[model samples]
Target: MGRAGPAGAAQESSLRLACVWEEPPAMGTCFGLPCDVDSRDEDSSQTLFFHPSTYGSKIRLYESCQVAERIDSFHDGIIFTSRPIHLHERVTLKILKKEGPWHGGLRVGFTSMDPLEIDASLLPPFACPNLVLQGRTWAAVLPDVCGEEDTVLTFWVDHRGRVFFGRQQGVQDILLLKGVPVRAPLWAIVDVYGHTKAVQLLDPTRLCGDAGEPAPPLSPFQSDVLHAPACREFHGRPQGCTEPCVICFSHETSALLHPCGHASFCYCCAQKVFRRSGLCPLCRGQIQNISQARLGT
Candidate 1:
């Protein structure tokens, strides 16, 4: 990714201050208690990014760790904010990219567990039944339409510990999950799964109605394949022709297929397959795009 020069940095600083005077919308009441509590003074003083240590193995952090992307097989991709958000502190993110062969969309919510205190190796591969079943975690798969690239989402936890998420177009929001035990500080959690490939966390100062500007494009140099095991076939001649790419068997396995989520073709072989049948060789699922799966950093 290209590093911003002094001029670019100055511009971004101005943009960040542009919305400081703008107030967030009033939140809904939960169990007769006021939900719109303001802690912007404390929250805005610190930078927000994905915690470096407590993320799943398939996840990658980028843009100074403000963006999260999934790689490899697409499962094992979960992340949490670096710090716990204050009550009604709206957390906003934009869908940077999406790919398919898989159903469902992004999942967002809150968790009471401190990320620093949890073991990353023990983190589940998913959020729905995997993490949520463990208890203090609450999340919901977004509507399929929300899977579209550039979709801006804002979510927060209310005073009653109910979770609500919605598009940033207006003040409207849908209750995602409830019964969260908010006795402890709550950190925002996101599952970059299925069709949702990459996401970028926006500044809390950028409110729903305030910023009309579109999400910024990611750095073209950003890489896929974070922490991926070195491909044996890609490095040297296949020993006894074992585990060669399912297609040509001449090179390392590359391009990952959507829906089927299979990684069985090199870039060249994938292009050939895409041109010939446009279907996954194993499952025969329709092809969407050809590329090794990884996101952000």
Candidate 2:
């Protein structure tokens, strides 16, 4: 048997994590059950999810077209910063929505372990001491997240182990959950686990210190993941034209099938591609026009 590559590993991991919350978990202890709002014990103070998904496990992103297209019930996301954070340092996790608080939104917070760290199919939510899981409006009781058009959330553990939460409004926190010790590394969790709300984690950065100096207001980055790929895929290049073009299966794509873009074929192969078919080869979007990808200008 051959070892898995990065892409292979990612796909396998996605498959395993894509279904952590299919059914509502039973109260008290749900080891491998769906840990939704129903799974949350009204008496418990900490977060709990027995059937936890793995870190960065997303449903639609990995499912087959049939399942993904019809996935209108709910969605969930759990990811961490590319790097680990330190105590007393402010870290911001921005939730950028493609649609919005359209249906059921996200249940956002931090967990000591990744959702996939456990082997429980009915994995319940785990809360570290005094953990805080904030949605759109408030926390505790109703765990609905589609309260407002919130796009940014900031979290930081103070020197005394208090975790603070806030939105794009500013450095000032909208909700504060105190007394939890910053025991281990914290990973951000978003439970969109049964709604059509498409959410993406953008630009997780350490804002500043929480000691003497007050942190500055959250601002937009000059560029974002949209403009550039966070990590290179192969040969010091973006995930583009790195493999065989799905259409011609011939030469590497010399021109980009722009607007509905993918370098699926060479310029010669694309001359009549759109005239015959108005769809993209990669994402299957309607092709507005095909443009040549420039290089070494």
Q: What is the lDDT of residue 255 in candidate 2?
A: 66
Q: Model 1, residue 33: what's the lDDT?
A: 23
lDDT of 2 by residue, 1-297 (tens): 122233344433442233222211221222233433222232123211112113222333211010111123223232232222355544443333334323333444444443324332232332111123221111111123322333455556564645566666455664344443234444444443323234333333333444322233223441232233222221123643154333333445566655534554556556655665464432344667666653212
Q: What is the clash count of model 2?
A: 27
lDDT of 1 at 57: 72
Largest lDDT belongs to which candidate?
Answer: 1
Which portions of model 2 show Cα errors greater than 4 Å?
1-71, 75-84, 98-104, 114-116, 120-147, 193-196, 204-297
Question: Relative to the true structure, how large is the alpha-carbon lDDT of every model?
Answer: 0.63, 0.35
lDDT of 2 at 280: 42
